[model samples]
Target: MSSSKNTLLIILAFFSIYVIWGSTYLLNKIAVSELPPFMLASIRFITAGLLIFIIAKLMGKSLAITKRQLINTSIAGFLFLAFGNGIVVWALKYVDSGFAALEISAQPLVVLILMRVFQGKKIEMMSVLGVILGVIGIYLLVSQNEVVSKEGSILGMVMIFVCMVSWAAGSLFVGKADLPTNYFVNTGYQMLAGGLMLLVGSLLFSESWSSPNVWSEKVQWSMVLLVIFGSIVAFTSFNFLLKRVSPEKVATSTYVNPIIALGLGWYFLNEVITAQSIIAAVVLLTGVYFINTKKKLVIFSRFHK
Candidate 1:
């Protein structure tokens, strides 16, 4: 591809992931208002999975995979979607969407620590500083009067933290695991597996299955947006960027997503952005920037040497 086209595609992919995925936090908050979280997540992933699977097949992409690959993908799916996303959806019942986004912004810090502990990766000083700042930011965010006053909000924040850990672990696992060559096909399989797990959880929790008529128009529309823009467009773009750009560059979405989510939540849902939250967001995003960019700077220095 020409340089211009490559740049354009990168910009488009970045926008998709940054804007669409960020918006999903607020949309999910809206969706779980009426629907059970597990059921709603299950339906969203299953529907998107089946649709994407069919589309991939129609496009001549093979869905063939070894048993081991299937198992690994399923495990990743369970971790990333069932636990990570499903739990957040449940927590949204108690937490503000903007607050949840702020909490999730620490994912890079979690992944950084995990990589060092499990993989024995060398941590840069900047990354370490980033982690420290991120933790401080989170402490400030959760210590606010708003979060403490709300019943169960503390537990909800803790659950969101766990969600980030699960997502980070799943991301690391998928990076090393054997899976389908086609990104869309692989994503479909992952979604299907995750959706099944969510369905099982729904059953175990005995979530009420309300009729479609009972769902508000906003909830219904939010679900549609999540399935289409959040899952299909943003996810596909994310996978595309992973292949074309440096992973650190692609990870910049972490810094951008929270801001977008905060804005959307404030504008649409009247979610309050407290002074503490704003300070935390700034600190958290700065940490994320350092974590992602410091390694690239190191690499550039090495090349120059």
Candidate 2:
């Protein structure tokens, strides 16, 4: 592809991950209001996974895989989707979508810590400082009287934190695990496994299921959007961006997503954005930016591996 074409494709890919994924938070909140969280997640992932798997097969991608690959992929899927996504959906019942998004935004920071602890990666002072600031930001964001007004809110915040940890762990695991060679096929298997796990959880919990006749239009539309735009399009774009751009640059979506989620929540759901939350967002995103950016300062160079 020409340089101009490549740039345009990159822009489009960036837009897909940044906007579509951000919007999923709000849609998830809406979906969970009517459906059980695990069931909702299960449906979304299963539908998306089946569609993607079909498309990949049509494209001549092999669906065959080893037992070990299936096992590893299943484990990754459980961590990333069954817990990471399912719990966040449940938490949305007690927290604002924007607040959940903000809490989940700390995922990259968690990934950094995990890498340092498990992979023996060298951590720079600035990265450490950024992690500290991110923790402080999270503290400030959740410490507000309005935020913890309900007892469930505290639990909700805790669940969101767990979601971040799960997602980070899954991401780290995927880097080292044996899986399908085709990215789309691997992702499809992960989704299918995770979705099945979630469905079983839903059954164990005995979650109530409303009939389709009673399902609201908004809930139906939101679920459809999630399967199409959130899962399929955004995921494809994210993998595409990983191949085309620096991982750090692609990770910029993490910072941008919260801002988009906050705006959408405030506009559509009339979610309150307090002064404290704004300040916290600024502090948190600044810390994230510093962590992701490569510094040329001499002091920072000393920590490089």
Candidate 3:
């Protein structure tokens, strides 16, 4: 591809991860409204993983991997998808989609703190400030009387935090784990593993299983978008941008996703955006920006050794 075309691709790829991923919060909120959360997640991931494998095969890419790689991918899959994402979807049943997205915007802050605790990595001055602001941001975001007073909303918020820890730990694990060289193959394995785990969880939880034909039209469309755009295209674009652009530049999605989620939720679902919530987003994203002020900061980009 020519330079101009390459630049265009990069721009489009960024858009995919930013807008598409940001939109997924609303999409999940929609799907989980009618479907069982675990079942919904399993269906989305399994479908995406299978589609990825098919696409890779058509591209003549190898899908073979060693046992250790498979194991690592499974671990990552559980942490990142089965538990991490699955629980968030479950939480969406009680919390607003935009609220969940805004809370997750503090992910880099959590990742930074986890690095310190697990790997003995030093928190630089800017990151320390980021962490402080992130804490305050979280408090403002979650302490809303109206939001928390809702039945089960507090538990939902707490579970979402746990999901953050799961994703942070997963990011740390993926930073060092040996996996397939091809991003598509690696993602396919991870998604499949995660999906299988979610299926097990669904059965254990006794979540009702229903056929797709029985789903509402809006939910069916939402599921389709989640599998195709949110999981596959957005995630692929994320990895692609990490390779082509600077990690810090790619990490801007961390800042953009919440705003997109908030807007979409408000417009489409009539989810209210509180004044405090808006303030929390500003502080939280600003903190994330400060955390990335250092050149080559991880920003969830394979920071572990």
Order the candidates by lDDT, highest first — what do you get? 3, 1, 2
What TM-score should be assigned to candidate 3? 0.91
lDDT of each: 0.83, 0.82, 0.85
Candidate 2 lDDT, tens digit per residue, 39-128?
899999999999999999899999999999999989988987899888999999999999888887777688777767876776677778
For every candidate in turn, the CA RMSD to the true structure comes to: 2.9, 3.3, 2.8
Off by over 4 Å in 2: 1-12, 239-252, 295-305
Q: Which 10 residues in a row give candidate 1 its minimum summed lDDT?
A: 296-305
Candidate 1 steric clashes: 0
Residue 141 lDDT in candidate 2: 90
Per-residue lDDT tens digits of candidate 1, residues 1-305?
A: 79999899889999998888899999999999889999999989888889998898899888898999899879978987899899999999999988988888888778767767887777787778888999999999989998879988989988998888897777667766787777788788888899999999999999998765778999889988988888777777776665565444455687688899999999999999998899999999888777767565465233222
TM-score of every model?
A: 0.92, 0.89, 0.91
How big is the RMSD of model 1?
A: 2.9
Q: How much lDDT does candidate 2 score?
A: 0.82
Candidate 2 similarity to native, TM-score: 0.89
